[model samples]
Target: MKCIIGLGNPGKKYDRTRHNVGFMVIDELIQRHQWKLDKSKFKADYTIVQTENEKLMLVKPQTFMNLSGDAVRPLMDYYHIHLENILIIFDDLDLPIGKIRLRQKGGHGGHNGIRSIIEHVGSKDFKRVRIGIGRPDSSLSIIDYVLQTFPKRDTEEVMNSVNKAADACEAWVHKPFPEVMNEYNQ
Candidate 1:
């Protein structure tokens, strides 16, 4: 079984904020495949979907961003999932808006959610799909910037990236991680 985890804060208040890009991508994938994410466990909302080749569990961590590992580690242990079988989707302020990047493994790079997951999992070798939210203006604090909602003018661009990130995820289900990275990391 493969697990795809989207990291973000839970609650309606964080919905559509830059920090919630991970949740947005997961929603896109669930909607596209007509899969329902109604199961609640391990501090997450998840659903299992079986394809001809694999059984996939799509998870949106409900423990919020900083404590995401609290949910992921337990879920993996219960499901007997290895680190390689996991892929995390989240937002990156370092990349420009509408851009996406895939990495086989790395440190959190200052992302609290990723840091938590790495700490709990004891490895930095899992795959990651980073959607760029872009940095805020110099005057704004990072915390406030990430929590801010995307402006109306940027909705189309953001959604386009979300769709592409969802597509990249689907491709990961069927192809090797390296191949998926090569295809989508343009």
Candidate 2:
């Protein structure tokens, strides 16, 4: 079994915020596949979906952003999933807005959620699907920028990026990570 975790802060207030794009993409996946993500265990809300050769558990960590590893470690141990088989989707501020980057393994790049996961898992050898939310041009604090909502004009691009991310994820399941990365990470 492989686990796909989407990092986000839970609650309606964070729904459309840039930081919650991970959750948004997972939500899109669940809806598209008709998978029900109602199970609450392993400190995450998750659902299992089946493909030809894999049973994928779609997880939204309810432990919130900072403590995401708390949810991931147990699930990995119980499911016997290796670090390579685990895929995490999260927002990145370094890339341009509405961009998607698929990387096989990398450092957290200063993302607290990814950093926490790396600490708990004791490895950075997992696949990560990073959706670029873009850094703020203004002088606002990084925290404030990520927590804020996107403007109406950018909603279309954001939705397009979400769709691309979801498709890339589906491809990731059936193909090699490098192939997925090459195709999606432009």
Candidate 3:
């Protein structure tokens, strides 16, 4: 089995914020598959779908961003899914908007959500899909920038990245991570 885990804060308040791009990708994938993350357990909303020869699980943890591992670790354990079989998607501060990057393994790069997952999962060796949100402007605090929704000027770019991120996820479901990374991490 494979798992696609999107890291984001839970609630309507954070819905369209830069920090919730991960959730947006999950939503896009869910919509494409005509599925819903209706099951709530391990502090996550998830759904499982079986394809011709494999199964895939779409998950959005409800433990919020910083405590994401509180849900991810248990869910992986319960499902007997290997760390290599999972891909984590989250926002990145280093890349410009409209870009998506994929990595087979890496550090959290100061993201609390990735930090928590690395701590709980006990390794930096895992798949990741990062949606670039860029750094905050000089006037805005980092936290404030991430919590705020995209302005009108950025809406088109953000939506494009979200769509590509979702496509990358579906690619992972069908092929290996390296090939999917090469295809999407342009």
Candidate 4:
């Protein structure tokens, strides 16, 4: 089965923060499917979806960002999901805001969440969708920047990126991931 893991800190405080773009995309997809994250285990909130052609899981790890592997590894083991069938969605500080990049495999690039997943999963070979949160200004600390809500000027763009990411994920349910990447990564 396929799995889509969204990395973010759970709860009200983290909602809408730049670092929570992954959650935003997952929320969009859940809404589009009218599905609820009705199960909680492996330090995560998740739901399973089964259709004529696909079966997959939507997951949001509740172990917070730094310890994400605590949640991911367990869920994968329980579900017997292959690394190739898993897609991780998280924020990227390198790309400009409102942009996204998809890759079949990559290093963590200093993201604690992705680092944790790589450590727990014992592989750097999984699909990823990185939504750009952008680097902060020199005056702002990375922690402060990532935890803050999107500025008014950036709200529209950020939401657009979230929607686009969600659309790409939905397309993955039917089309191959490479095709989805080609369509959305341009």
In order, what lDDT does every prediction score?
0.95, 0.90, 0.92, 0.92
TM-score of structure candidate 4:
0.98
Per-model TM against the reference: 0.98, 0.97, 0.98, 0.98
Pairs that clash in candidate 2: none
Q: How does model 1 fare in lDDT?
A: 0.95
Q: On residues 158-183, what C-alpha lDDT tens digit does candidate 2 reach at each position?
A: 99999999999899889888998899
Per-residue lDDT tens digits for candidate 3, residues 92-112, read: 999999999999999989999
Residue 128 in model 1: shift from native, Å?
0.2
Clashes of each: 0, 0, 0, 0
Number of the predicted model whose TM-score against the real structure is largest: 1
Candidate 2: which stretches are off by over 4 Å? Answer: none
In candidate 1, which residue ranges exceed 4 Å CA deviation? none
In model 4, how large is the Cα lDDT of residue 45?
96
For model 4, residues 77-158, the per-residue Cα lDDT tens digits are: 9989989889999999998999998998999999999999999999999999999999987899999999999999999999
Quote the RMSD, in angstroms, for model 4: 0.8
